[model samples]
Target chain A: MDQDQKKETAIGSLFAQWTKSQADLWEDMIRMQFGMSDASEKSRKNPLHQTQKAYESGSKILGALISTLSEPENLESALKGMDSLPEFMMHITQQAYEGYLEFQKKIVEIAAKIGQHTEAYKFEGIDQNIFKVWRDIYEKEFRQYLNVPQLGLNRFHQERIARLIDTLNIFQASLNEFIYMFYIPIEKSGAVMQEKIEQLAEKGEIHDNFKEYYNMWIKTLEGHYMTLLKSPEYAEVMNNTINALVQYREAKQEVLYDILKEFPIPTNKDMDELYNDLYILKKKVSDLSRKLEESRGV
Target chain B: MSQTNIAVNLILKKLAETTGKAKIKVRKASEVLLSPLDTELSKTPYEVVYKEDRVGLKYYKPSEVKHKYPLLIVYALINRETMLDLQPGRSVVQTFLDSGLEVYMVDWGYPTRKDKYVTIDDHVNGYMDNIVDFIRKKHGLPQINLMGICMGGAFCVMYSALHPEKIKNLVTTVTPTNFDTDKGLLHVWMKYTDAFLMGESYGNMPGDLMNLGFLLLNPARLILDKYVGFFENMDDKDFVENFIRMEKWIFDSPDVPAATFHQFVTDCYRKNLLIQNKLELNGRRVDLKNITMPLLNFYGQYDHLVPPEACELLTKAVGSKDTEDICLKTGHIGIYVSSKCQREFGPKIIKWLKEREGEPKTDKSPETSRTPSGSKIRRETVKYVSPKKIIGKESKPASPDLKKAK
Candidate 1:
């Protein structure tokens, strides 16, 4: 009934409530995951069900520690319970790591199949699925880390840095794709030229003049390039590459602006504003001079 | 001998010859590259007569001026006007001068950061109008003959529409006024280009980037075959000089003013406003019907940048009764630089302008000049006369007989 005892009892009750809520939340998650009303016999055999059980046991151990700590005489027992915490966390982490490895293995298998299909010439363009996979993986897994809600006085600066890094990666990927598209024409032209030369050789029509071959190869390359460049696919990729480059440049300029704020040299933003103002002022003067000239009939 | 043995022997023989030729070519190329070569461009003697910010006006007065009105030429902002006077034998400016025509060309100097805000209106109405008026005042005339090249041609068209009284005859060469056609890769790509984003991000549309785009239009030829051809002909000194001169001109690009680039792409390329006469510059619509001057529109048949489709429609779109569209048998730069076109292109324009010279300015009233004035808009009538026919068996100077009926 004394103040210290009353405080210990209140703390004990709070810890007990927390432990019960945590257990209830785990049970609800397991049930929802299994689409079951309760943790039935069938559900208990599930790996997630085992995970729920482990969570419950961990919470129970924490509850025991809280109760033991509340009673000053059982402080040793509470410490012993705290010693088991690391082991419990290891078990949960191990399970999650195994799950991630399995997922990655399946993705790798799918990616390998796509690679095979691309080599088999199933698709017309540079294998975009590989790039798509990389982008999807980054977007789904790593992008969230950079996009995590930043806090503190330097949060804006931090976010800009993050954006710069993100845009740079995207721009580089798009550039790679664009370069690959360009390489396609050269590759096709070489292959086609080789085939043509072989056919000519077989027909015993091979010319001694190497210039003929050079001309044919170049013309073929130009034709291939024309077809590729005019395609909607190439246009789309070019636009995407340009957009990525622009975004990267803008993001980089923003970070540069922050860095250059302390320097004596003017940044593009500063110069742009000044240029815009000067442009307007000069235009007005030019217009006025023209009007004046017209009025004078000169 | 067996066929395989014969083929192997032939290959070996060809390889030996190629190696021998390459060695000689490399030595000759090194000598040519190291020697004091006359590879300079714009060799025609001219004086810078007027200056306005980054723009300059070059006056190339013929020894004897034949026409009553001086011909003012406006070159595109994309590249330096040095292209017109690339070399002694291949210079368009020289051809005009030889024909006793006084030439005034606009040298749009390299734009810096300050020039990023220069718009189409500034180019067409501001600088172009000022230059026209300056020429008119200097010559003591109400109007002067105006000619524009590439994007400059588009500017001339706009100027002629806005101020018809100042242009006695308007000539557009390799201009892309009707950008709606997808016959050229530039038109197709420009439709997808984010011009505003490009302008805002880079401040000015970088000349180097534009060159890269141009190279991509035909990488096989521009990037690959061009170098291969150079190496093959490295032993020829004349070829080397001409090639080097052209290389200098091709790469000597100037950054386009950002605002002008944006408006051109949006109004002309994407919206197809210039051809539709819906393009507005400085609150005034560039109504094609306002162009009442004798219009001579010339385009290259093989021009990949500005196809004949893009250039041929301007003559029909204009209000001028005396409009002619000449589709030269060449590419964009070829129309000006190619030896074959040097005979056909310049002479044809001179003849057309000569035919309309000294005529009274057509009244600008809507009812007066817009109607059929008996002068027909000639289309596909001028054939590419053989160089042998024009330059006769006696090796006479080549002159296109514009009066000859096909």
Candidate 2:
């Protein structure tokens, strides 16, 4: 295989593995939140048995999608297969809105239950007229405010969250298509491959193609590897990717911090922290593999 | 400067020579027909009629007057007062004279850097006081019949209010009283205007700049259309002269004394304190309600500069039970020189005054008494008759631009 194809295969495999690891960690947290585990025999007859069963099924589906990104050929095929994802996401977003309406109905039911159990006592501001006004306002408009119309981001706080997650899946599928559509063709064609590699390197990113190409080229011939190394592009790609990985980690941490602040779903936080630790391990392994591939002196 | 003078002299001489060609006997016929053509061309003969130190007022004696007491014409400090007596027949002063009224006008004179310190108090209390006193002394009259134009009208109104007993009758023409109005852009813009920066930058606001601002309020007509029309009608000498004369008067602006400008803009128009009868000059409160004298208040219906809303406010503010507000179908300047004003406005003012004064021939009153601040308490009484020709020596040509743009 050509250096470019090899690099593509390497990147595709690494990205898929990282995604699968993240998915696995999330699945583990979901099981833990529901007080279930592979070792628990009572899970079979538990009252919330469906929740544990659903988590397992969802994790498996997500894992399969992530694995498809691991191989160069599979990644290319997936990009072609998901060309209409952006349009699909739009349809999915509409369905999520309907789900949110149902979720709002459930919230009203819960609010009524809470009001039945809670006692109210007020002396200073208990105007009967103001109560009517507030009741009218609540029925008319205030409930709709919880949905962020500006971002068109679907809600996910209640059972409606499943529909929102489905929309996000489509969005991510489109983003993956965007990555493959650009990265695959450039890697397949060796003409000006170094230039494309350097460009991507300047962005501090290691695309699948560059990683595979460098590994394969180093293994083939010592003289060729030395010649390629003499070109500053090789060193530049490595430096840029390292910088990108650092930036990516920092950005991910920020996103986690923001999510924690807003949602504070402890189970999700625990899963996120677990994923981060695994990501560090995965990055260390990838770096060791790259060093071993280089030192072989192809 | 000498060349400008010579050019002006040539034009005036040419105009006179042309007048001589006609059978013009009376000053009225000569001035009416000739004055219109004097400022026709850009190169026409027009000059500053008078320029002197702090004292350039053209004082008149009772012996020189055709009527009993002198007619004190108070024009706004913003413009040259000579517009009232622009030329013989077209002149308002000439009309008063023809009707047997003695005329004496106060000239504030051109203010310079040294005069920038002068205030509203100085002009109303000091300069005006001295002019009235000089007339009273020269003619031995206790008070004079006072008529103020525009800002000069406001000054005269205040003067009459402080010393109502001295003014036999008061006539204010196109005088702004209620400055709070949307009819004129100037009043509204002035509420937030910073004259301090303007004065600091330009020393004194240039007359052209002030004029331009006024013209801009209606640019399509005042600034552009009028000038274009003037150029188009240049072939007609009469049209050309009137155009240049009007341009001259409009552009001949006096640098307003800084202090006076500050007070006028801040205290009067911006605050609308004058009409409220809450304004004070020096230490004395100017209460418009103090004016109980017979008043003839005139306004121009088409005066965009001073809307009737502003000019008519005087009727409501005054203490005079006999206040008459006449709305003329004319613009600001037309109220003074329009044919309508000549035939009706002038006659009406004289009749009103005559009625209030009780027919000058029937009643003989004593010298006007003075108030605490030396302001005359009542109109002075005297009897002086007209001669066929008590010729006023021709005034030197007022600078071509006496009425600066604003």
Candidates' TM-scores? Answer: 0.80, 0.45
Q: Could you give candidate 1's per-residue lDDT for residues B226-267 as a string of tens digits? A: 676677777777777777776777778888888888888888
lDDT of 1 by residue, A1-298 (tens): 8999899778767766765666566666655655543577987888877876776677567656555555544654666798899987887567556656755776677677652422211125555654555666566655666788889999999999999999998888889878878887777777778777777776788888777887688767767887888888888889988898999999999999999999999998999899899989998898798799889987
Off by over 4 Å in 1: A1-126, B1-6, B359-406
Isolated chain A: TM-score per model?
0.61, 0.25
Tell me the lDDT of candidate 2: 0.57
| Model 1, residue pairs in steric clash | none
Worst 10 residues of 2 chain A by lDDT: A118-127
Which 10 residues in a row give candidate 2 chain B its minimum summed lDDT?
Answer: B388-397
List lDDT for all candidates, in order.
0.77, 0.57
Positional deviation of B265 in candidate 1, in angstroms?
Answer: 0.7
TM-score of chain B of 2: 0.74
Interface RMSD of 1: 2.8
Which candidate achieves the best TM-score against the true structure?
1
